[model samples]
Target chain A: MRLAILGIGPVCALGSGIQSLRTGLQGKVRPNIEEKIIPTSHGEKMLPVYQPVAEGLDRFIPKRALRRVDPFTQIALLSTYLAIEDAGIAFNDKSRVGVVFGSGYGPTRTTFKFLDNIIDDGDIGASPTHFANSVHNAPASQVSIFLGLTGPCSTITCFEHTLSNVLVTAWDWLNQDVVDYVLVGLGDEYCDVLGFAAVGMNAGRTKDMQPMNFNACTFLPGEGHITFLIAKDKSHQEGYAKISEIRMRRDLEEVKASISNDPVIINASGNLQQGKSFLKVQQKQLKSYSNLYGGFPTSSAFDLAVGCVSMKDRKIYPVPESQKKEVKLENSIICLEFCREDEFNIYKLE
Target chain B: MSLELDLKKLIIEELKIEDVEPEDIGDEDALFGEGLGLDSLDAVELVVILKKHYKIDLEDMEKARAAFASIKALAAYIRENSEVQ
Candidate 1:
């Protein structure tokens, strides 16, 4: 069974919704990176991080529902609601739908806040509300509760490849006839701790975040959420792109053998070492998307979203003007992502 | 804020009791089950609040249940057992 993307809701550093993302990809808007100071052992350090533009989520979700959820969970619910609305699908029976969400760092701020309460004022001072929302699956649970979906609900937290795993798992559920529709996506939030870690780990090499540049040592930390409503290929005619195939590889040879020299969108927003390795992939044509969304573990989700838009619009959002080249748009688009030192995911979108 | 008013505000804010104001919560109203409709999670949070703010720890399950029976009962328990001045 083939799975098709019926709707996409992307809340990223570029902007919220497809139009904002498309405009950002067209080089009409630059990424909004904010400089913030984070506390360190000796003093304070400043770092550049990509913060998502607020979309006034209160307008979509009721105040009662919003009070109990954290920022990450709020983003997930809003994105999912937007996707379902975008698909124009009505829920007659909520049990026929499922939710699968992924996150590189799940509810980091909430977890830390709970820990702070415990450490600062003992266990009795810890907020039970914060503790309830600190789990990795909190976003998924919130989505299911807010949307009243009773089908299969799960969450994956595998750092960079979380989105890939969520997509693959959702595909399996759809193929098995477990659910009629599945909302799969990723939601990660930016925290000062993450910023401090990113900067401290790559002190010398880190620079302003830019995509596809193998020579840059620094990547800007980013956080956002993107959700998609996916269903069987023949089930819906309004799909953006049909997911032809998905493959994961741990060995370089396996990735090389599976990859064809077709025009491909490369996710080159990883560390310098991974960027160097991605540079070796011989492709007839190549493009990078990290420039628009900034560098993050789940940044590939943005790339895939852009790929779907490009496919449907019959236009390719080019790389930076300095590295711009003629890209021949085709019916099929290949997305190559190197998520980790030993892990890579290849997606065939048509 | 007075102890009762403080408790009401804390309950409303911590438990995320929506569409309800601090003055709306009756002193003798049930905290769980029928009145405010708080669940077991809210009960646990109430315990934390009592201990953290009032320095009144109800270690015994029976006494804790009795104290949590109503907003008035919780306030009374805090008034009698509070270690904080």
Candidate 2:
């Protein structure tokens, strides 16, 4: 069965919604980076991170529903709601709509809070509410509860390629006829622990963060959510793109064997590791959308969203000062994501 | 604030009870089941709140269940066992 992306909702460092992202991408808006102080052996150092804009989130979800959920879950729920509204489909049978979400660091803030309570005041001081929201599946559970969706819900956390894995799972569910539509989202939240660790790991590397420069060693930490409403291709509703193929490979040779002359969108999010693998591909036509979304594990979700927009608008949003001046949109666009040394995933969008 | 009123506010805030106020909860209203719509999870949270705020540990399940029967019972139990009074 063929699957189509009915609607796209992206809440990123740039802003929320497709139009906001398009404007940011086209206008080459400067990234909103906030400085965080982290304690080190030599004293304190400042770490720059791309923080998402916090306005207009309350409009997407009810106030009562936001009380218990952490910010990670809130972004996922809001993006999912926006995608549902964008699709313009009201599910009378809520059970027919499944939710598949992906996250790199799930509820890190709540996890740290629980840890602090336990460490400071013993196990008795740990807050049950924080403990409840610290699990990896909490975001998916919140999506099901707030949306009243009784269908199959799953959360995938495989680091950089998490969203790609989620899309593959959703594709299988649609092919199996388990649900008529699937709401797939990818989200992550910035925390002190993650930011400090990132700084510690990249201490001696270049501190200047730039996603457009594939050779840059700096990977700016970022967090946000992006959700897509996908359904079978039989609907009369217009869609951004039709997903033709999804594949995950464990070996680099297999990925190279499967590559063709198709226009490819690479996931070089200013990370040295991802850039190293991205440099291996000799494809003449290449594009990267990480500058608009910043660099994170699940930032590939934003790359896919940009690809869909490129297909719909018949234009590609490239890096501001990259060597490539023009982007020719083909009938089918291939997305190549390099998660780590040996694992990669390829997506075909038409 | 009185311990009873303070307990009501704590319950309302910690449990994220929607559309309910501390003044709305009667002193003798049950805290579990049909009274406040609390469940096992809330029971655990209530135990933490008691230990954290009042320094009264209900290590015994029976004593905890009895104290959690109602807001009045909880306030009385805390007043008797806690050093706050």
Candidate 3:
């Protein structure tokens, strides 16, 4: 089903909402982490961290509700609230609304706390509340609970492709008429021990590991939540962009063939002809925006945000690539592709 | 045991900095952009960590920013505001 983006909200190092984020993207500054906690011996040094801009939580969150949720959940709920508000949808009738959350790592603090208690004071020390909040689906569940959503609720954790995975899932939900509106998001919170441990375990396996452990230029642990409301009808508030299409492919050649047929190719490689000859037939603009956003899992969320803003501004901010100065946008034609392990590829054309 | 030393240890523990001990973090060192090396994100995360550890809530950014400047500063802030007598 075709879905229109009604509203968008994000908390990142770039700042909050669309405008600050737009400026951040255009500037292409690597987010600084500077988190104090470093290894006592042999571990990664933290660098640029993704922090949420402290807006008045009381403005959107109830005092009683905030008492029970973790900081990550609070960020997710706030962003979700902003999406609903931007969509101009009344929260009273939520039976028609669905929620989907994407996370590379779910609520690390909650999980960490639970583990700490279990190790320190035995299983009896584990708090039931913390245990409940530690699940992968807790973020999405919290959204439903806070918004009173009775519709379908789901969560997707596909490592780096989390946002894209959720996007595809949300697109399906909208197309099948499962729900008239859907709130989709991705949230990741930093856990110092977990972050270091992940890199330590995966160090030899992955090429793009966190840098030197202390610089934000590398993978410093970050916490951020971005929410979008998708509906059949266009949103009342100014929408940043809309989903053109979302497709997942198990084969790269199949994706290449499909991309060759698309009208726009926003390849991460900066080579427009990187797809296929069929796509190469046209004099389509080839550009990259990686330098702007500094490649992350939910970077697509930023890309989608950029696409939305580009639609509004009528200009595509070009990444520093080759002889190409910039990619101009006469109309809103954007294609997003995410590939993992060369075995799976997901393409979304909007 | 000085409360400031304990606070530094807690910061190191909560932030999961395995390399440093309470002695590494000076009582008057800057937490961000210098001495202790924390950013705005760490400041926010520290809010929850402090609440859990010391039972103190630092909500305002200005206050959080100031308290986070150094282990000593954070300890002083905690001592002044903590309800436990």
* Residue pairs of candidate 2 with colliding backbone atoms: none
Give the TM-score of chain B in candidate 1. Answer: 0.90
**Stretches of candidate 1 above 4 Å error?**
A30-32, A54-56, A203-207, A250-261, A282-284, A320-328, B1-12, B17-40, B53-56, B60-85
Q: What is every candidate's C-alpha DockQ against the true complex, given to 2 decimals? A: 0.54, 0.44, 0.03
Q: Give the TM-score ranking, best first.
A: 1, 2, 3
Q: Answer with 1 or 3, whichever has the higher DockQ.
A: 1
Q: Could you say which candidate leads in TM-score?
A: 1
Name the better of 2 and 3 by DockQ. Answer: 2
Per prediction, fnat is: 0.78, 0.56, 0.00
lDDT of 1 by residue, A7-103 (tens): 9888877777777788887777777778878777867777777777758577777787677788888878777877777788887878989899888
Candidate 3 clashes: the total is 18
lDDT of 2 by residue, A178-256 (tens): 9999999998888888878877777224444655455667777788898999998776769798888888764677777
RMSD in Å for all candidates: 3.4, 3.7, 11.7
Provide the fnat value for model 3, as a fraction from 0 to 1: 0.00
TM-scores, all models, native as reference: 0.85, 0.84, 0.65
TM-score per model for chain B alone?
0.90, 0.95, 0.85
The model with the greatest lDDT is 2
CAPRI quality level assigned to candidate 2 from its DockQ score? acceptable
